[model samples]
Target: MSSLKFYNEEGAGQQNSDLYHYSQAVVLGDIVKCSGQGGWDPTGKLDANDVEGQVDLAFQNVNRVLQAAGLRGWEDVYSVRSYHVDMDASFEFVVDRFKKHCPDHRPIWTCIGVTRLGLPEMLIEIEVEAYAKKA
Candidate 1:
């Protein structure tokens, strides 16, 4: 059986992970699972004020988490789940952004509209599962 491997970005140990008690992502063998990421920067500050900008930053954070786990890019992602504050407003933008990022390899996607996220200022949260064969 393979053991779990965890990845947390720099400064996260003393900042986000310590305060929130969560790792950015974990890997088990060929599969990688990541915590939902918001538009917050490394310091946990909201980087984007609008939905489009927030969606862009959230994807960047997800990519950062994936790279930390030794994955190349979103091309390794097989599935994605996003939580949005307003489905009506966020739905279109989210789909468009996903297409923009994963233009060649599209991951199975699930988007949910929630009453709110962990932070009130956050407009969207994204989580992903990716796979890469042992090399």
Candidate 2:
């Protein structure tokens, strides 16, 4: 089996720092595992206090990571897991946002309510897994 490669693109990848202990997107053979993406801006700061803005930012973060791995948008995502601090607002925001961003290709998704995240101001975080087409 081939080893995985991680990327720490710093602001380029929308991550705060370019020094991730691990790779941003690990490519193990044909599968790519992306890290949890939050509602942080390109500077790594949370954008808004509300669920709608936060959810949009989270998807933007995920899009950047996926692009870094040379893949398309949500269509490349095989599975997704979202962590929300407030279920009612955050869940609805995510569902609506997903419907708009990923209308046709519905990937497997899981939404979980959490007490807290890495940052206190962060309201939502999303992680994704994608499969690369065979070469």
Candidate 3:
């Protein structure tokens, strides 16, 4: 088994010093499991509160992690989970974004509506699982 690697791109690991158990992505052999990413930028600031902006940022974060792992694109994604504070308002936006990004292949996805999330201003958080051929 290959060892795992982690990343804290937004400096969350440093800010929350006690949060040592989290990682942006973990590489286990040929698979990469990405943690849930919100609509925050590298500076840990909320970029947007609206559905489209939030979804776009969330996918951007995921893409960064996937690129770090040397994966091609969303084609390698096997599963995805999106948490939405307002499902009715955000569902269409999320679907459209997903279609735009991962048009060829459709991965397993789950969209959940929740009352709250880790951040009060965040409207969406996206998590993904991907696999690639061991090189």
Q: Largest lDDT belongs to which candidate?
A: 1
Candidate 2, residue 25: CA error in Å? 1.6
**Model 3 agreement with the true structure over 21-58: per-residue lDDT tens digits:** 56677777788888888876655667445677888878
Q: How far is each candidate from the true structure, as Cα RMSD in Å?
A: 2.1, 2.2, 2.7
Q: Return the lDDT, model 3, position 10.
A: 42
Segments of candidate 2 deviating more than 4 angstroms: 9-20
Please state the error at residue 27 of candidate 3 in Å: 0.9
Error in Å for residue 131 of model 3: 0.6
Q: Can you give the lDDT of residue 51 in candidate 1? A: 82
Order of all candidates by lDDT, from best down to worst? 1, 2, 3
Clashing pairs in 2: 6-23, 7-24
TM-score quality measure for candidate 1: 0.90
lDDT score, residue 22, model 3? 61
Error of 1 at 50 (Å): 1.4
lDDT of each: 0.82, 0.78, 0.77
Off by over 4 Å in 1: 11-14
